[model samples]
Structures are given as C-alpha cells and as structure tokens.
Target: MGYYLMKFFSWVACRFSMEKCNSFGKVLGKLTWIVVPKKRKFMAYDNIIRCLGVDAGEAERIAKASWVQFGPMLMEVLRYPELIKDDYIKKYVTIDGLEYLQEAIDNKQGAVIATSHSDSWELMGAALAQYGVPLVGVAKKQKDSAMDRFINEYRTLVGMHITYTNGVREMFKMIKEGWMIGLITDQDPLWSDGVVLDFFNRKTNCFVGPASIARTQKAPIFHGQIVHRPDGGHHITIYPPIFVDQTKDKKEDIKKATQQIANLLENHIRTHPEDWFWLHDRWKSVREKGLD
Candidate 1:
C-alpha cells in the first residue's frame, strides 16, 4: 500500500511541473508549523537552545520555522523522480562546481563526497547522477523494509547506487572499483561508533565513518551541498577536495579529517540557517547527561 502511494505521488509530481510541486510544498510547510507534536516541538527547541545559545522563546520560534522547512524537504524527496531530465536541471537545479567533480573522475582515484542534511540533499544526488557522474550513496535502512525498497528503486532509476550502512565490505569493494561515494556526515552517531567533536560551539558526537573510510581507502574528501535559493532554485556546490594525511599515526589523521568535515558542515548550516533540518535531536545525549 505504501509502495503504491509513493509511486502514485511520484507520478503526480512528475506529471506536474517542479514549480507546482514547490508551490504545494509552501502550503505543506505552513501546515507543518501548526501540526507537529508537542514532544517533537520540545526536542527541536532544546536542540536549538544548545546549539545556538538562544533562549527558550527564540529557540521555539526557530524550531517551529525549521519544521516548516522540513515539509518542503519531504516533498522535495518525492520530487526527485521529476529531476532526471535536462529541462528540470535548467529549471530547478544548478551545478556550481562541476570542474572539481570532473577532475576527480578524470583522475580515476575514488573521491568521498560529504554533505549535510541541508536543502534537498537527495535531489543533489539525483542531479549528480543525471549529470553522468558515477555516484553511490550510503544509507541507513529504514525500519520499514518496503519503504526502503521503494526509495532504493527511485535512487536506482536516477542512476545512483546504494550500499547499506552496515555493508562495510561492499562499500570497500565499490571504492576499490573506483566508485565515488556520497555520504551525509551531519547526523549524531551511535555511541559506539561516534567521537565527540565541537559543533555549533558545543561538544557533540559525530559519526567517524567518513574519516575511517577515507583513511582506509586513501581517498580524497570533498564537501558538497545543495543550497535552496529564496526563489526556490537549488545551487549545488562541490568544494575542492580535503585530503586526509595518512601518516604513521592513523588515529590522529582520522580525528583531523572528521573535524574538517564537521567544520565544513557548521559553516554550511550557519550560512543557510533556515534550510537545515533543525528538528533533529542533535544534542540530545549531551543534554540528557547534563553535559551541554
């Protein structure tokens, strides 16, 4: 049933124009501001307070507005199927740093592209795949296996491949085969796999997967994001590669690489404050432990 629902919505989105879908997104965004639950609202508020050093009232306002942005982000994912063609590329998304990606591909050395949970990230992947880049993404499996399958299908249709987060062996194989890996590096990691890092002026735990993977594979890391312009168009930027020094001290190199990625994410989120998904409990564990 969910599969059919997603497929039907996807078809509807493609049948209409991207502009119409964004118009619907605006209405959905307003509705989400009014309807998100109190508990989730509190979580968002708390996260903002810790990360931004804002008082309760201001945090609440930002959190509410953030939820509004999330509505469009949700719609944007369903809109990915529509963006595979040239018409949609020119109309909605613009690539700013194609040279960097092209250079990496020309070198035949695999690259690690890291992005945060910023505006229409999934759309960024779709656009890259459409542009003829060999892209593969690492994704956590959704609790609902059917929904996961449906999303994987869409990703495949757009020419992006997916490797589950737990498939370390498979990921290594892809990297060895010279496939560029795209990963989201802004989420809080599980306690076992994460290291504490300073983010938004607070010590928060972040996943070390990007650094670990890069160190193991000797890959160059690049930061990229899709920034949503006020006019509803996306500007995708792929920055110059950040190389990890693989010296005798592997652990130190990992820490430095992870910190560099975190710093990049901080700058991106700070620049486009509203476009980020602020509803996540990014500082939850620290707050719960009374450490923030």
Candidate 2:
C-alpha cells in the first residue's frame, strides 16, 4: 500500500513543473487540514501560542499554513530524481552563504550542518549537493520497508548520502570520509541526557548530537535556514561556521554550543514562523518535565 502511494505521488510530481506540483501540494495540504483530527489541530494552534506567544487568531493561521506547506515540500522530495539538477534548483531556488559553507568544507576538520525543520529541508540539502557540494543527511525511515527504501533511493539520487535514524555510527563514519554532515537538530526529545535550552523563551530538551560531535571532531558548524518566497520559490541561507570551544570543559562547551544553535533556530523560526513545522509538540519535554 505504501509502495503504490509512493509511486503515485512520484508519478504525479514528474508530470508537472515544480510550481504546478507545489499547487497540487497546497490542495492536498488543505484537504489534510480538514480530515486530520480536530484535537490535534488545536493542539498545534495552542503550541504556537505557548511558544511564540502569538494571539489565538494568529497562531491558528500559522498552524493552518504549516499544514499546507508540508504537502508541497513533500512533493519536492518525490520529485528529487528530476529536481536535483543545477539548472532546476537554480531556476527555482536562490542560495546564499556559499562562502560560509565552503569555509566549513575547507577546514580540515569535517563540518556539521545544524539545520532545523526549516522550509523544504529535503530540497535544502539537494539544492546544495546539486551545485557540487557533497552532503549527507540523516533520515527517519517510514514504517513500511518498501517506502523507506524508495525515499532513501531518491535522497541518494539527489547526490546526498543517507544515514537512517539512530545511525550514529554511520554518521561519524561518513564524516571520517570527509562528507559534510547535515543534522536535523529540531526534533522534540525526551532523553534524560539531552541538554536543556531556551526555545522561544521556554526551557526544553534539545539535541546535543551535533555539538557533541563538533567538539570531539573539531568540526566547524553552520546553521542552514530556508524560506519559501512569496514568488513560489525558495531562498536558502547558510550562516557562518561556528567553531566549538575545545579549550573549555567538554560538557559546558557542548551546552554552550547547543544554546547557540538554539539561538539560531529561534531567530529563524521567529522570522519565518509559518515556514516551521509547528504541528508537533516541540515543547513536550518542557510541559511534561517542567524544565528539569
């Protein structure tokens, strides 16, 4: 069932221009917003109010747009086989911060791309790789094995390597081989070992994997943020490389770096709040544990 759904979506994506495909995504997103459970819908709307302190009306609007945005972005994932070309990405997406990315790559130490669920993140990595940057991003596999394989194959087709969720060993190994690692650092986590950081002025558990790896490997870091323009295109910004403080205590340094990454994420999300994936309860840890 998953396999056929995947094929259907992929075929539909290939049948149209990127803009047209995105229009289809918008329609699907609207349908999903209507059909998905009502409780979950308000949960997201409430989350925006809690995190961003937006009024109920504005939060509701953002939450609705969030649902609509994902459909089109997921289409870009399916269209990877054709969309990962330099001409195509350049045509529809404008990329900045090349010098920062190049600076990270130039450093002998491998670099970690600290990116959040900003815009079409799949397209973010693919667009960079299409321009001759060798990148590898981690993915969470689908429950259906066939669908998982299909998705990863398209990711690789975009010229980025894959490390499945919890592929820590694979991630480090790829870094050792000089591959620039792209880590999605914005998932809500509940691990006791996770670091606590201020997200939108509220305390929550945050992923320390990128910072921990940066300190141990002496790698520089860059925050990748993308925004979908009103003109139906995307603009990607790669902030400058942040080198960790190995000279300080490892634990303290990791916490500081994580906080800095948090700052980057918060800034981007604040600027383009609608572009973020706000449906998930990112503050779940804070709510459940009370800033412990």
Candidate 3:
C-alpha cells in the first residue's frame, strides 16, 4: 500500500506544473476550512489571539492565509527532489551571514544552526546539504512508523541526515565529527527541561537545548529564517552569529543566550505574522499555570 501510494503521489507531482500545484493548493486551503474540525480551528484561533494580543484580528487573517501557503508548502516538499536540482531555487532563497558559517567551518569547529517551523523550512536544510555542508537535522519521530520511515527516506534522498529526538548521544557524536547541527527551537519544550521565557510578550517555556549544546561544545550559533516572498518563492535570511559565552556560570549563559534567540524569533514572527506556525500551543504550559 505504501509503495503504491508513493508511486501515485510521485506521478501526480510529475504531471503538475508549479503554477498548477499552487492553484491546487488554493483549492485545498478552502477544502481544509470545510474539513478541519471547528474545535481545532478555535484552538488555532485562540493560540493566535494570545500571541498577537491587541492585533488578534490581524493575526487571524494571517493565520488563515498561512493555511493557503501551507498547502503549496507541503506540495513543495513532495516535489523537493526535483526542485533542489534547479539553479533558480537559489534566486528564491538568499542566504545572508553565510560568511559567519564559513568562519566557523574554517576554524574546524562544528556549529549549531537554529531555525523555526517557518516557511518551507525543509528546503533550507536541503539547500545547505546540497552545498556539501555536513548537515544533521533533529526531528521528533512521527506516530506512524511507516510514515516516519517514508519521510526519513525522502529527506535522505536529498542528502540531508536525520537524528531522532531520543538520540542525544548520536547528535553529540555528529557534532564531534564536525557536522553542523540544524535544530528547530520554536516548539514548546517538554516541561521538565524547559525554562519559561517571554515570547510574543507572554511567558512561555522554551527548549534550552541549542544554548546548552553550544555552551558545552563552545560552538558558534547562527539564526536563520525562510521568509515567504510575494512572488510565491522563499527568501532564506541567515542572521549573524550569536556566540554562546562560556562564562563561569554555565546556567546563566544558557538562559541569557536562549532568551536572545527567543527575542530574535519574536521579532521575526512579528514582521511576518503569516509565515509562522500558530497552531501549536506554544504558550500552553505557562497559561495553564495561571502565569501568563
């Protein structure tokens, strides 16, 4: 069944032009509005409400627009094997602050590249891998074993490496071998290990893994974002290096650096409200505790 489904999807993808795929995405977006349960929609709306506060109305518009963008985004993922081969993909994605990445590589020190679940994030990893950068991405295992296997195989097809969330040791080993680690740090962290930080002007628990690893390994940290362009393409902006200072107080350094990253994330989301994933309960833990 999986083999047949994959082949069918591949055939459909091959037959459709990029413009046709985008038009189909618009139709899919409308279908999603009809099919997605009201409860789920309300939850997404509520999350956006909290994040945008007084601008909730505007946020809702952007969130809904994101559903449209997300459809094409997923289709792009399905078509990635062909998309990566085209030189024009470079025109859509502009990488800033690459010199900082080069500096870290030249120093023989592996670095951590942190991004969020923003616009077409998977493409960003594929681009780096295509340039022969030993990029390893950490991801949570999907619930369906078969689906997880399929997605992993697809990623590897484009030359990107994957490390499951449970494999901390493997991630450490990859870094030690001078492979750059790409992590999505915007998700709500598990309660025990996360620190409450201010995100979108509200208190939220954020994962400290990126900061922790950077400080421990004395590695340079770079922030990057894949912004959705008006022309239906993406622009990948890489920010300057956010070096983790290894002071005497390691915990303090981790907290400070993590907060810095959170601040940057907040600013980006503010500027491009529609490009972010607003469906997740990012502030749930704090709000549940009556802290927010």
Using lDDT as the measure, the top candidate is 2
Model 2 alpha-carbon drift over 4 Å, by segment: none
Clashing residue pairs, backbone N/CA/C < 3 A, model 2? none
* Higher-scoring candidate on TM-score, 1 or 2: 2
**TM-scores of the models, in the order given:** 0.92, 0.94, 0.92
Sequence-dependent TM-score of model 1:
0.92
**Candidate lDDT (C-alpha), each:** 0.80, 0.82, 0.78
Q: How far out, in Å, is residue 67 in model 1?
A: 2.1
- Candidate 1: residue 136 Cα off by (Å): 0.8
Per-model clash counts, in order, read: 0, 0, 0
Better of 1 and 3 by lDDT: 1
The local lDDT score (0 to 100) that residue 30 gets in candidate 1 is: 84
Query: Which candidate has the highest TM-score of all?
Result: 2
- Which is the winner by TM-score between candidate 2 and candidate 3? 2
lDDT of 2: 0.82
